[model samples]
Target: MNTKQSRIRRSRKTRAKIAAVKAIRLSINRTNSHIYAQIISADGGTVMTSVSSNDKEMRAQLPNGGNVGAATVVGKRLAEKAKGLGIEKVAFEAAREGGLVF
Candidate 1:
């Protein structure tokens, strides 16, 4: 298969592993111009908390949220929100063609 298809294959395996663990998940998504993160329940049915560069508060602090710095900011913000929502730890999930990160 080609590179894109190979990546998707890898990601599907990763997601299947995550699903098997049946733990809360910290899902992250990064695009060319923004980063987003969310804390989902063990069954992945509930969103406990979420944060993104698109948020008004984060947007005001960042001129643009496309780089690693923006990812870090979104990660920290999401962590805080999750903590406030009583979430202390989680597994990580990613898209079918992506990888997980802290």
Candidate 2:
């Protein structure tokens, strides 16, 4: 009915679609002051890897974590972590309302 409700409905449908695929997911969340990325297991019970602009290391490197540059940094960090864990591929799940269901 309202915008927030519509966004929630869209996100719910997206989550259902993701679950049906049974594949690892790379989810991204961007807020006003931070960016976060996560790798989730197929069943969504496990978080394989995660990185955020709020991390201590990232915080030091990025004085301002609200911009696109900060988001890119978070994304790259997440990718590196995933690679180290041998996660070569995943389904991209961009949150309609800014977070994954899990």
Candidate 3:
């Protein structure tokens, strides 16, 4: 399989395992210009919270929304939102399956 297809296959498997345990997940997605983060329900049926560099508030504070600084802001914003929702724990999914750690 190609790189993109392989990554998808790996992520599906990892997500299946996480779903089996019904654990909240912290998912992140990075594009060429922006980074986005979200807290997803165990069943993957809903997104509990989300943050991204493209947000209006974030965009105003960050001169360049695609840099690491912007990503850091998004991450912190997501964490604060999760805490407010009473979500104290989450499994982090890296770029894709087998990417660094969970």
Candidate 4:
């Protein structure tokens, strides 16, 4: 499989495991030009909160929005938004399935 397909396969497996627990999920999608994150309900119909470099606030801080710094900034913003949405905890998915801890 190609790189993108392989990544999707990995992501599906991770999402399946997360779905098993049925907890609120904070999934991240990092693209070459931007980073996006969302807090999804356990059933996946609703998105409690979301943020990205494309957002107005983030757009100012991360004008380029395509670097590790931008990704980290998006992560922090999403977490803060989730907290405001009364989501104190979440299962974070890297979208890349990195070796880094959750």
Q: In terms of TM-score, which candidate is strongest?
A: 2
List, residue by residue over 1-102, the lDDT tens digit for candidate 3. Answer: 899999999999988888889998888889878888888998888999999888899988988877878887787787778778888778865443222224
TM-score of 1: 0.84
Q: Which consecutive 10 residues in model 1 have the weakest lDDT in total?
A: 93-102
Clashing pairs in 3: none
Off by over 4 Å in 1: 93-102
Worst 10 residues of 3 by lDDT: 93-102
Tens-digit per-residue lDDT, 11-92, candidate 1: 8897778789887877778899999888788887888788899999999999889898888778777766766776766775
Q: TM-scores of all models?
A: 0.84, 0.86, 0.85, 0.80
Off by over 4 Å in 3: 94-102
Q: How close is candidate 4 to the true structure, as a TM-score?
A: 0.80
Q: Candidate 1 deviates by what RMSD?
A: 5.0
Output the lDDT of residue 51, model 3: 91
Better of 2 and 4 by TM-score: 2
Against the true structure, candidate 3 reaches a TM-score of 0.85
Pairwise TM-score winner, candidates 1 and 4: 1
Summed backbone clashes in each candidate are: 0, 0, 0, 0
